[model samples]
Target: MLATFNSSWFKLLGIFTLNQTEVKAFPMRWFGFGFNAFGQICVHEELIKGVWSDAVNEVKVSTPTELDNQVDTSDCCLTTGYQIRASWSRRASLHLDGFVSNESCGKPMKESRGCKDAIVSESYLTLAFSDRLESWDLQKKEQTPSWSMKLKPHSSGPPVNLPLVPGGYIAMKPPLYRLLSPHLRAKSLALSAEHAILLTASGAVYTWGLGSHGQLGHGGLTSEEEPRAVEALWGMPMSCIATGGWHTVCVSDGGDLYVWGWNNSGQLGLPSQGLRKTLLQQSSQLAGAPCQDASTTPTEEPEEEKHEEVFISIQAFPALLDVTPSCEIRTVSCGCRHTAAVTTTGDLYTWGWGDYGQLGHQTFISSDEPQRVEFFREQQMRVVDVVCGAWNTFAAGVKEEVA
Candidate 1:
């Protein structure tokens, strides 16, 4: 017998099916619409409407474009000088545009995970894997034997790959490597141009390398060859950490953000006025200036005092930053001179160097404090991840209404 079916009910079901299909098909697309001076935006040629060729300029993007290539997974992606290397689960693709070199192509990496997980500096590329660590000289276009080291088995445990030695190992252990030996269980590592930081599973942070700008989180501007714990956060348990060109950031177990190091660009979320005052104070001290009595000095107005409290130029030690006063920060990432953070509610905040719109504020104005990027909120999207290039920012977000 032929039965009459309710067409209205069928239509409703079809609409629901279409919605689900759309959600699945468009699962959070990656938006990389920032600095592209060297063609690091990674969008398909057809997708790029205009180009910004200036060494440090922002791309005028009306909308977020989907990344051309699909990345299944990645250990990390590092950029330096004029090139970018994106590490995948099983391999890595090195992108070098004409701005960087004469050729523009993707160089397939070796099969090993270490080869895929790589870091780059102005003159060299270092790859780290489970078995060994290798270094390639970018200037010479040849591998250096002295720069490479085989993973050695620890006396108490299995083989562990040592951190990348910036220069080369000498007869004596570099101060940084010496400090790392005592703490054999390293949970994570972050590097910049001249410094390296290691976070232990127990929430301790050790840093070594160039400290000219106090990026090491120590209370002085001196480089250390061996890793040294950041005393300011000695007892606080940290969950994650990241380093920029000359700054450092870390999050505590309770989702508190702490920052220190170079504030020349206000990357520390502090005001430059305080830094100037600090420099003057140091200069006076060196000149053996006489100390003024508090009773003889004029009292600062309440508003002026409040302003001074927030205008800090340099924080040699880790200082707690209350950027998301009401929201807890889940993760943080740093660009060459910019900073980005993700809140538990999936909101994204950016600040610091924005000359190339790396701060993602829709404008190329730098910020001294963390500011929320309203693009995600305006679209009813939730940011799930954030990655920063030296002069750019990338974010992935999913629709809030998607089930």
Candidate 2:
């Protein structure tokens, strides 16, 4: 008989050991909603025993208030526990009711560090987080399904047409944009979409927007009004790019990994959190101080006249991953506060935000540096692909059979 509790907020959540040897609690005040507006739970064995023995309170409620638009379940709703239900190759669509703890809760002996709840259906892109649920349609943008549910913002009457940011809309769809010339495609996308990134079939990189902590990789604190190519990686060529909140990481074609921007918790594989904190302190601390060095830069050129000002501040810079030359990583993924990677040798490594076993090390302690996932040591497995939820990790590939 498990005890259950309900509240508008969950700050009172806490856990205690069955032996009474330890007690810990997550700070409710600091428990801000994440990408998916849900919380994750990763606990030790003793603590789970207490929960199952009716010593704890569980939350029970339906989410999204209620399904606004009904769809044909005959075409969807297999409910396998993946965030989206359909395969990535299919055209089916479905809504998900994801709660990190919902799929993860089980007896202590079978603890899982991967996503506990996900509802993915066949859609090209299924992105879920503590803050938002996003899906992309690669088939036909305009002809595809559009949001139908009406949302009532705090003071609103009814949700109407979703408001677009200034200069946010494009007359053409994503496929058309991809088919257009690279320069034209780049110019059309919004500079402010958080997930925006430029990738070449051969792996070049560029970015803009929300560079406060230098997530843009442009070596500046200012968000660009337009797309800017990442010159530092001009010739290197990249295979993929992933963003984690304000931080970013890229993978190279030769199984090499490069990371930069917002390394607050060692997400960039850097030695300090100084760079991240500097960006938050003030806009002036960023590299693109529009007014600095004005006197020395010469005011003769009219185009350069904008440099007329004076101030000293911190600036953003691209920091390379400090890993040794031999690591040879192949795939990279980012969670809201952590990162995971799979190397060519079939080894998996993870770091940052282990509070809910997001690191999959079977521990709640966080690490500042990349740590090989030793949890699978006994299984002798090989992780080929990796995906990260807001606070959990998912990997697929081959693993040795158990005796």
lDDT of 2: 0.43
Candidate 1, residues 193-213, lDDT tens digits: the string is: 678778887999988899988
Deviation (Å) of 85 in candidate 2: 10
Winning candidate number (TM-score)? 1
- The 0-to-1 C-alpha lDDT of every candidate, in the order given, reads 0.59, 0.43
Best by lDDT: 1
For each candidate, C-alpha RMSD in Å? 14.9, 16.8
* TM-scores of all predicted structures: 0.66, 0.51
Candidate 2: Cα lDDT at 223: 80
Candidate 1's C-alpha runs over 4 A off are: 1-28, 43-64, 70-107, 110-116, 128-130, 142-179, 274-310, 401-403
| Model 2 spans with C-alpha error above 4 angstroms | 1-195, 273-315, 322-325, 401-403
Q: Which ten residues in a row have the lowest lDDT in candidate 1?
A: 9-18
